[model samples]
Target: MADTRERDIIHAFVELSNELVDGYDIVDLLSGWTTNCAQLLDVAAAGLLLADGRDVLHVVAASSERTHDLEVFQLQRHQGPCLDCFNTGVAVNVPNLEVEAHRWPDFVRIARSKGFASVHAVPMRLQGTTLGAFGLFGDTPGSLNEDDLALAQALIHVASVAIINERAASDRDVINAQLQHALTGRIVLEQAKGVLANEGNLEMQDAFAVLRRYARDHQRKLTVLADQVVNREVSGQEILRHARFTSIRP
Candidate 1:
C-alpha cells in the first residue's frame, strides 16, 4: 500500500508538471488538484479557495459537494480554519471540531453537521504573499500525521508556483491579473456545468467531466470553452455528442 501510495503521489506531481505547460487552464488544474489531495492524503474530502485581485476569497475547487458547501459557508461567515490560515499565511489544524467550537463556533457547527469531525487548512503562499488556501476534511476526529501535513504543504507550494510562474514573478500586476482571470473563469465554469447538467440530465460531476474531456480532445482552453457554453455560442448538445463519441471510441 505504501509503495502504491508513493507511486500515486509521484504520478500526480508529474501530471501537474505536464499541465503547467503553456496555455494550461488554471481552473481545471486546481479542480484536479483538490481531487488528488482527497484521494492521496488521509482525508475524506478536500477543497481549495483562491483570492481574487481584491484579495477576496472564492471557492475554486472541491472534491465533494459537501466540502464545496462547507468552504462557501466559511467564506460567508468570514470565520473558519481556512480563512484563518489564509489571513495568517500559516496552517490551521483542527484535530477535533468539538474542541474548536469556541474558536470557530459557526464553522465547527456546520462542519460537524456535515459529518466532518476535523479539518486542516494550509496557505498557498509565494514569497511573503498568500494567494489562497487548501483545506482537508476528515470524517473522524484526528490530526493528519506529520508526513501527511508536510506532503499537503508541498503540493500547495507547487500549485502556487504554477500559478505565479505563468507570468514573471516580479510582475505584480500580471500576477494579480492572472489570479483574477482564474477566479473569473471559475464562475463561468460553474455556469457551464449547470448548463450541461440540465441539458444532459446528468450530475454536476459528470457534466464537468464531459466539459473537460471535450475541452482536452479539442485542444481548447477550458475557460474559453466554458464561456462559449455559457453564452450559447456552443450548445451543450454539441459537447454531449462529442463526449458520447469519445467514450465509445475503440
Candidate 2:
C-alpha cells in the first residue's frame, strides 16, 4: 500500500513539474505549488505565499479559500510557524495543533477552530534566499515521516528552480526576438539601397548618402524608408525634393 501511494505521489510530482512554463502566470504558478504540495505531501490542505520585489510577503495562492483564510489568520495574528520558517528559511513542523500547549497561541486557536489538528511549514527558498513558506494542514497528529519531510523539502527546491528557470527563458526569448528584428532591418536597408540607385540612375554610394540624409532629416529609420522605396511605395523625387545635392542627382 505504501509503495503504491509513493508511486502515485511521484507521478503527480513529475506531472506538475512538467506543467511548468517559462514566464508562467503568477496565480497559476502559486496555485500549482499549493496543489502539488497537498498532492505529494501527507497533508489535507496547502497554502502558498509570495514576496514581491519589495520584500513584503502576501498570501498569493492557496488550495482552498479556507486555507487562504487560515493563512490570513496567521498574517493578522502575526504569529505562526509559517512566519518563523519564512524569516529563518527553515521548516516548522507542528505535529498537532489542537493539543500542542507550546504553540503560537493565536495560531493554535484559529487552526483548532478550523479543524486542522496538525500543521507543518516548509520554507520555499533557494540558495539561502527565502521567498516565503508553504503550509501543510493535517487532520491528525504526529510529525511527518522522514520520507515525507524530505519530499516536501525537495519540492520546495524544485519550485524555486522552476521559477528561476522560467524567468531566464523569458528574458532569453525577448533578446533573441530583438536580434532577429535587427537583422531583418539590415536586409530591408540593403533592398532599399538597390531600389534607390537602380530607379534614380544614381551611383550606389550617392544613393545611400541621399537615403541617410532623408531619413535623418525626417527622424525615420533608414531601413524603414528603404522598405518604402523598394516597394515603390515612395519616390526618390518625394525624398530629394527637400535637399540640394551639389554632386548628386535623383
Per-model TM-score, in order, reads 0.93, 0.61
Over 106-198, each residue of candidate 2 has an lDDT whose tens digit, in order, gives 888878888788888888765445667888888788788899888887777776665555344345444334334433554566567677777
Candidate 1 ranges beyond 4 A from true positions? 245-250
lDDT of 1 by residue, 41-144 (tens): 97999999989878899999998878988999999999999999999888888889999889989999999999999998999888777889999999999999
Query: What's the lDDT for candidate 2?
Result: 0.69
Q: What are the Cα lDDT values of the candidates? A: 0.89, 0.69
